[model samples]
Target: MSTPHTRRSFIGHAAAGFSTLALPRWGQAQPATEPAPRPAQIEHAVTAPVAIEVNARPIPAFEPRDRSRTRFGSLQYRSGLVLTSPHRGFGGLSGIRVDAKGERFLALSDQGSWFTGSIRYSGRAMVGLDDVEAAPMLNAEGRPITEKRLWYDTESLARDGNLVYVGLERVNQIMRFDFSKGGTRARGEVLPTPPAVRKLPYNKGLEALVFVPKGQPLAGTLIAFSERGLDANENLIAFLIGGPSPGQFSVRRTEKFDISDAVLLASGELLILERKFSWFTGIDIRIRSIPLKSIAPGALVDGPVLFNADLGHEVDNMEGIDAHVTAEGETVLTMISDDNFSLLQRTLLLQFTLVE
Candidate 1:
């Protein structure tokens, strides 16, 4: 297990490698002109889905300094890729949902665009992506959702069968889309939330979402977590919407980390992917495992750290995570990074197997 102090020490050791790097401030807004015009502009021009070519380069090792090492905490590194595309609206991926077979995937950008594709795999290792397409998220009026005021910072995503939920951080709102209607072309409607959800601080609200499906502890519930929303006790505030116990709860805050993305396992464990940034340390990412049965309204939940990585490992602004079970019963976790469309950053896809 990694305590705050131990993690800090690890970061300090990794600082030397990142000293010359100028990393983008994760989650902060930048000028549209700075990043070759905002992605929304490019997406807006795309009224319908457009096929895009995404190029992927393999990451042969998780830690370049230790190529032979495969285990990090409770996870075993499988493979990784550096993803790039010629499409201007391709980066800034903040959320993703992978299918049960770990092939088909649906991802979204903070600029209010949708990306759908399938992963090409060699046995259990990811080799590349194929048949990718990009489209703008449409409103009920069939216009781009970015057309709405303060609606482009779409940060979180959750899926239940054919239904998809998107959380916009700038305005602290969630939108519901029925994929059965039109897939990524589906028009979205606002999903009403608790009053406090709308009151979270701008830029720090609605960062991660997890939809608990049938047979789970919080089945039929959409769990929404703020990036840094704090309660009276200073714990991270989260909401349980449209469930048997629909209300608020807190996740015990530790190590100054904020929630980035989350996934609910079939075995009833909620795996939260979190990250923290500092001028001295660059970026650090980790995963925590919380028992789903322990979550309830007004409850303060905590979990054990299952994995941890720093700039020492292959990582960027990691923001999305999903898990699938192999036919052999192995649980595999996939993670994606939000590049923020900055030339200084990169979009990375990584995978690991849960060893615990």
Candidate 2:
């Protein structure tokens, strides 16, 4: 084993207008944002697809806590695997989403690549990935986002019907893609997020996005959260956009955990994926649930920790999450990690049965 490196995360630059979103380095006032009438249409062209491929290897053991395969909290480990590709643009996958059937998956990298693939199963356990394809996240001009700008660090994703919303962390902006027409080839139009969102610290802003389904309590509401965006009082901030209610709320920060990703359950409960890093502990990840009915303006939302794991287990910088239902009516939670395109880190895909 390699010696665990001891280091703390450093602050990054803010968005276009703000000096800082949470922690002020220069101390400046934040500008307010005027909400647009709705999502503006993006005029994007179809670009030639980039050639990409992936290789998957099997990991036989599902349980990482121990040899017993005992359940931990409400989640049971299903399987996990590391993914690699010869394509140089691969890795840094910070956001992910899956179809209702759990078969198809889409993940976006901070490096501006889109990874699409399907899950392959052997019996009931996940065995590998299939039909994997990687493409650049195109800009409004139909060129790769990285080719367009340096700040296009795609980090979080939320989907409702044919509309998909992707969060760019370093730039502190949200881009909406209308897939009802061209699918992944759809042009991306910027969404009018709150001025506070624009103030979030670069590389930590807008880490999680979840859209409540029509039947949910907060139906049609779009929820966006920061990785560690703190208020003057040091409360973690979250925004409720669109829907019947639109406002800001707080989520209590504990154990140095920051939001990595989140998914909404059929029961209207929000499952948040949080992570922590330390020289002593290396890395730690957890899942916490907050009731949708509890999230309101200025509400301090907190919930029981459903699951937790550390570096002793098979984990890296796990950052993306999505949920799907099985034919047996079971809910399966899927997660992915951002390798940071580093040899020291790995791109991992893990799954577990959510037995709430």
Highest TM-score: give the candidate number: 1
Q: What tens digits encode model 1's per-residue C-alpha lDDT throughout 1-356?
A: 44343354345435433443221111234466786646666444545688889999999998877899999999999999999997878888999899998899999998898999999999888999999988888888777887777778889999999999999999999999999998888999999999999999888999999999999998899999999999998999999999899999999999999999999999999999999988766788999999999999999999999999987788888999999998999999999988777655678899999998
Candidate 2: C-alpha RMSD after superposition: 10.0
Clashes of 1: 0
After TM-score superposition, the amount by which residue 50's alpha carbon in candidate 2 deviates from its true location, in angstroms, is: 4.0
What TM-score, over all chains together, does every model reach?
A: 0.88, 0.85
Residues 217-334 of candidate 2: C-alpha lDDT, one tens digit per residue: 8788889999999977676889998888889999989878999999999887899999987655567789999999999888999999999976656667889999999999999999
Top lDDT prediction, candidate number: 1
Candidate 2 clash pair list: 21-199
Stretches of model 1 off by over 4 angstroms after superposition? 1-45
